[model samples]
Target: MSQITTTCPWVTNDPLYQQYHNKVWGRPVYDDRELFAKLCLDGQQAGLSWLTILKRQANYEELFFDFNPQEIALMTQDDVERLLLDTRIIRNRAKINSIIGNAKAYLAYSQNGANSFSQLLWSFVGGQPVINHFNVMAEVPAQTPESQAMSKALKKLGFNFVGPTICYAFMQAVGMVNDHLTSCPCYLESSAKK
Candidate 1:
C-alpha cells in the first residue's frame, strides 16, 4: 500500500517526525508509562515546539525514571535539583516540578481506583476517538470543549500543568482524538480500527 504524506507541515519532510507521524502519533496508547510520558512531554511543550520535545524524549525517559508515575512520585527534592542541572531536556524549574507533582497526583488518582490513566482520559470521549475530518491544518482546533472539561477535571483531581490547550495536545498524542487531516493516510487507517 502506498503512503499518503502527512498534510501537517510539522510532520512533513523530517524522517523522525514522519516515523512518529506514521506510527505512534495518532495511535491509541493505553500503557500507563506511555500515557505519563505523553502528559509530561505535552506539558513541557507548552512554550516550545512539539519537535523539540520529540527530539528530547529519550533524555526525558532517562531522567524521569522511564515515565513511571510511581517511581516519579517518589522522587525527592534532591532528585529535582539534579534534574534542574541537566541540559539534555528542558531545564525549566516549574516544568520539572510539575512532572513530579503530576506523578504524585497520578498515584493518588490510581489509589482512588482510577486505575488507568488511559481509561480516565478515554472516558471523556466515551471510549471512542473524536474523528475530525479536517481538510487543512488550519481547520484543526487548538482546544475543544472536551479538552476544557478535561482540564478542569484534572485540576480538580490535583494534576498540574493541565490547561485546556495542553490537555488537547495530550488527547491528540494518545489518540483520544484523531486530529489527522482527512487526506492523510493515517486518518483513514486510524478511523478504520475499532
Candidate 2:
C-alpha cells in the first residue's frame, strides 16, 4: 500500500477524517443539494467542532431529508420540534431554523433566473479552488476577503448565520477554497484537479 501524508492533525491518523480530507475537502461542489448540505452543516458547526458534526452526518441526512432544499424549505414547525428531541444531530432551534430559512433563500435564488447558489459562490474564485500553501494548520486563515464578500452577499439575499467566519468555513467545506496544508499529499492532488 502507498503511504499518504496529511497536515491536519485531526486527520493525520483517523480514517474517517482522512477519507473526508482526501476525497471531499477542497473539491469544488456544484450540485445544489450538496451545496445546501454544506451550508447547513457549516452553520450548525458555529460553536461545535467539525468532527462532531461529521460523526452525525448520517443522522443529519436521514432526518434532514437528504438536504434537498425544496423539501427543507417546506419543513414545518412540527418538523423542528421533532428534530429538537432527536439526539442524532445538533438540537439547537436557531440552527435548525437557519437551515430552513437558508433553504427558502436557496430555492428562491434558483428560481429567479440566477445561477444556482453554488455557481454564484464558485464564481467568486472563478470556478476554481484558491489553493493556499500553508506549512501548518494554524497558518490556515479563518476568514478572507472572498469570505467577507460572500457573507455580505448572502446577507443581502436574506440569509442568516452567514458571518465572515462561517462563510469561510462554508467555502472550505464546499471546496470554494482549497485550505489543505502543504505537507498533506492531498493538497497538491486537490489543487491539480483545478
Candidate 3:
C-alpha cells in the first residue's frame, strides 16, 4: 500500500505540477531577480493556466537572459519578433512585450536608492508572508486590497499586465501571501516561515 499524500486541491497528479506544488508554491522568495522572474511568469499566465507557463519557464529564462532586468530592458522589437516564432513559449506578442516592458520598468523602479525591487514588493505585505487559514480552495480570494494596491503601484511605475488578479496570483506565487489550505501539509510549513 502506498502512503497517500494530501496537497492543495489545485495540484494535479502531473509530476511537474506536483513538484511545483510540493516544493515551490507558497514558499517565500526574497531574491530580487527571482521575484522579478516569478512576477513576469505570473503575468505570462494571464490568459492561460499556470501549468502552461510553468512548462515553459526554463525556455523563458534561457531566452530572456535569466530574467536579468537590465538585459531584458534592452530587448527590442526584433527580439520580440524572434521570440514569437519560438514554440517553447506562449508566443503572444503582447505578453512577450509586457515582459520586456516590465524589465525596463523594474530597472527604473530598482534604480531608486531607498528600496530594492524586493523591498518594494515585500513592503506591500508588511515584509512578511500573510498566512491564511482557509480550509478549502473556494475560500481563496481572487483579489484583495493589498493586491489591488500592488497593481496600482506597479502600473503607476509603468509595468504592464499587473492587474489586481495578476498581482494576487503573483503574491501567492512568491509567498507574499500563503494560500495553502489549512489541511494541506504545505500550509503549516509555509506559514511557519517568517
Pick the lDDT winner.
3
Best by TM-score: 3
Once model 2 is optimally superposed onto the true structure by TM-score, how far is the C-alpha of residue 157 displaced, in angstroms? 1.4
lDDT by residue (tens digit), candidate 1, 1-194: 22657766657477777888887777877777678778888999988888888889999999888898888988999988898899898988889999999999888887887558778888788888888888888888889999999999889988888999999989887888888888888988777764
Candidate 2 root-mean-square deviation in Å: 1.8
* Per-candidate clashes, comma-separated: 0, 0, 0
Please give, for residues 35-117, the per-residue lDDT of candidate 2 as tens digits: 87888888888988887888899998888889988889999999999999999999999999999998898888888997877
lDDT winner, 1 or 2: 1
Better of 1 and 2 by TM-score: 1
**What's the distance in Å from true for residue 75, model 2?**
1.1
Taken over the whole model, the C-alpha lDDT of each candidate is 0.85, 0.83, 0.91
- By lDDT, the candidates rank as 3, 1, 2
lDDT of 1 at 10: 59
Model 1 steric clash total: 0
